[model samples]
Target: MWEVRLAKHLKADLGTDTFDLVQVPTPEPAAGEVLVRTDYLGLSVAYLEMLRADSRLPIPPWEVGQRIGGGAVGTVVRSNSAELAVGDLVRTMAGWCEYSTGPADQYPGLDPDLFPSPVHYLSQGPTAYYGMSEVAKAGAGDVVFVSGAAGGVGSLAGQIATCRGAAKVIGSAGSQAKIDYLVDELGFDAAFDYHDGPVLDHLRELAPEGITVFFDNVGGEQFDAAVEAAAPGARFALCGALATQIGDHEDRFPEPDLTAAAAKGIAVLPFSTYHTPEQVAAWTEHFSTWLSEDRFVFPHTIVEGGLSAAPQALVSLLKGSFKGNVSVRVAS
Candidate 1:
């Protein structure tokens, strides 16, 4: 089995060199275990923070030489339990590896026919849906704004806000192409490139009346700007800090302004999606239904070259080289 592992605890820099993809003896399934071959690996910004030497995320940090764990979908090639059968598709936390061995229950069976492609299931949708629908509670009459709206969770968060009936959905991105993608492809009411001018100025112009729901993905300036542009009592569903999550970012963990939000009575709620079974179920149910209803767009990008390409794919993801949900096809 081939797997990528942390070469060392990350310090000031992160790149493809940070990982080592090596071959190991494939593990055999125990009496109650199953052996699965990796097919697709989901990449998210969460992994960037996890790689750092001092990570603030609630999740534990990875140790040197540890297997890089993440979301993955694969086929059960060998099974010793009744929970799953050979050739059945499943979602697992056994990412970055060509093969995995675990209890049958850990790799839950998934119907391959559910999504248009296995790639579709590799998403940050649980977080996106949780923030927009639950935390922000976006709905009709709400003027919703999403920061870093071209990335995985942001892309879906903006669209989820729209589906939940936000009267207007506005998004902020890094470039004109991403702005166009948000508005034209994802159905945002308006989209702006933060690089065009002051983020505050962009927000004030696009959401002049004041935004009632702020689905924030990029923190720092965008959070400050959103606080300034928010209507009284607006809900801020704090999701990601893409601006600082990058390894090379200066002030990679800058504190977002909360005092001003308090003075303005805007609800600043920061939450994390643990991707529990309930969360996965809620998102997949809504996602499938929304796609069937033709009211939602599943924006995604799949990187080829299997497991060996996974490291570079993750590096590119953090550098904003791709859009929407990102995944690596680890196998055919």
Candidate 2:
């Protein structure tokens, strides 16, 4: 077995020099433990940002030779716990490894029938569910705007808003193809390419009446634009800030001018999965129902070469070079 580990803390650019693919002896299950054979690994922008020396996340800086942690779905090849059996599908935070052995409590069993593709649990399910329903409180007849609308969470957020009965859903993406995807496939009322014009201008053109709800994924100029175009008493869900993830620590994300927000009685709420475990179970059940009913659509960009490709895949995602959820296949 092999695992991908950090070779060194990243600088401005990340590459092979920042990672090491090392062979390791296959791990064995211990008492109350399970040995999982990894099938797929989910990449997250938050985890990528945490790998930097001066990360904005509230965690200690990553050290060299440490196993990169994110999300992984696999099968339990060996289980010493009576509660689990061989061949059980499971999800864990075991990261970029072909196989992992950990306490059974660390690897939760997932229903293959409900989650046929376990990656969806990481991609479109939990985060999108909470951000829209719980944090943003999107409702019928509300006009919603989603920034970074082509990426995994944003894409799902838009679709979820539509399903939640938003009067109109507007999206902003980095490319024309993504804009087309949002409008044509995801049922977005309108979408724009952020590169084509100033973000505020694009928002003004796409949503002249102003949006009642804002789902913010990219927090730079897009955030400013959304604030400028927000309706009276509008709600803003502050999600990930992709701009700050790529920029140096000294580079601050653009703050929305509060004068307009205050005048309009707008509310801005920042949320994260870390503070909302109760929402996870509720949203997961809802997401599974939505998936079965075909009320939700999730698109992912899969990178081949298994664990070896993970580092670069994450780099591409942080650089905004890929669309939708990014995942790596570790085994069949």
Candidate 3:
């Protein structure tokens, strides 16, 4: 078996040297435990931020030569629990490894008939569903704006807003191709390339009347623009600070001038997938239904080389080299 370990706390940009691939003897499952043969691994900005020395996540600080934590989808090659059987697909937080062993209680079984693929639960599906439908409460006649709209969660957020009956959906991305993808492929009502000029100007031009809901992913300048452009009684879901993740800053994100947001009576809600089992279940059902009906579009980029490729894959995703959701194929 092979596993990826944090070589050291990252002081600069992430690269292949940040992690080390090492061999380890495979372990057998114990009582109430299962051995998973990893098939796919999910990468996100959160995972990259965790490698930093100043990570604010509740989890203990990362140490040298420790297995990095992440989400992965695999099969139960060996099982000791009554709830699981051999060949069952499951999702786990144990990632960047060829094989993983954990309590059966920890691995949530997935039905192929419903999910079809394990990567569906990785980042885009549940995050988008919960952020847009539950946290943001996007509804009919609402004008919605999603920052980082070309990325995994943002791409899905825009489409989910449309599925929820939002009157107009606006998106901000880094490039013209992404803008075209958002408007032409994902059904965003309007899309803009933030790099073309100041984000505030772009937002005002695209959403002159103001936006009712903002699904924020790339904080900093875009966040300030969204706050400045927020309509009265608007709602905002603070999903991710992608700009901060890649920037050379110790602060989590840039502070937005909230005078306009306060005057407008807007509600800003910070959301996390952790400790949200009820919301997870609800959104999972909703996502499954929408997916079955073909009412949502999910675009993903798959990188090869299994566990050894995860570091570069994550770097590519954070550098905006890959559009859409990113996943590493560990096996067939």
Candidate 4:
């Protein structure tokens, strides 16, 4: 079996060299345990925060010489308990490894036929659903804005807002192609490229009267812009600060302009998706129903190459080289 371990803390610009790949003997499943084979490994720019030396993320940072952690879906190749069958599909947190032996309860079983593919289960549906639908309360008669809207959670956030009946859902991405994909494919009413002009100008033009809901994924300039463009009594769901946490170490945390927000009476709700069973169940219910009704599109990019490719996949994800949800296909 092969596994990837953190070689050192991440620097400003990221690369595959931050991790080391090595071979390890596959451990045999013990009593009440199962041996699982990696099938799909989930990727997210949020992993950048977890790789930092002094990470402020709710979860602990990945330690040097230890296997990295992320989401994954796999199949049981050997089972020693009645909880899971040999071919049962399960979701696990034992990432960056080709195979793992763990207690049957550690890897919860998932319905293989519930989604179009296993990759759909890899999306950040819980975070997106919670932030947009619950925190922001986006619904009809509201103009919604999502920053970094082309990335994993942001992409789903925009679509979830639309699914919840937001009057108009707007997004900001890094490229025109993403903008087109957001509006044309994801059913967003409008989208803009943050690189083209001042985000404030773009937001003001997109939502002339002012945005009523902001699902913030990137915090730097976009956050400031949203504060200025937010209408009175608006709502903001602060999901992440990808832009701030990416570059120079000194700029990892940026403060929001609360003075403006206070004057506008905006409800700024900062939240973390703990991915509790309740959260996962809510997202799966709505996502499954929405997909069956043909009201949603699962925008995703499947990266092929097994376990060794996982590190580079994160690099490409943060560099904006991929669109929507990204996952490494470790096996068929």
Best TM-score among the predictions, by candidate number = 4
lDDT of 3 by residue, 178-216 (tens): 888888888899998887888889888888888999999
Best by lDDT: 4
CA lDDT of each candidate? 0.89, 0.83, 0.84, 0.90
Candidate number with the higher lDDT (1 or 4): 4
Per-prediction TM-score, please?
A: 0.97, 0.94, 0.94, 0.98
Q: lDDT by residue for model 4 over 77-97, one digit each (tens)?
A: 999999999999999999889
lDDT of 1: 0.89
lDDT of 1 by residue, 73-109 (tens): 9999999998899999999997689999999989888
RMSD of each: 1.5, 1.7, 1.8, 1.1
Question: Mind giving the per-residue lDDT tens digits that candidate 2 earns over 1-332?
Answer: 99988888766666667888999999888899999999889887777666787776666766789888878889998889987899998888888899999898888788888766777767755777799999899989999999989888898899889888899999999888888888888789999988887989977887889899999988878887888888889999998887766556766344557786788888988877662457768777777787789887777888888788888888788777887898888895
List the candidate 3 regions with Cα displacement exceeding 4 Å.
246-249
Better of 2 and 4 by lDDT: 4
Candidate 2 clashing pairs?
A: none
Error of 4 at 99 (Å): 0.5
Evaluate residue 303 in candidate 2 and report its C-alpha lDDT on the 0 to 100 scale: 83
Shift in Å, residue 164, candidate 1: 0.5
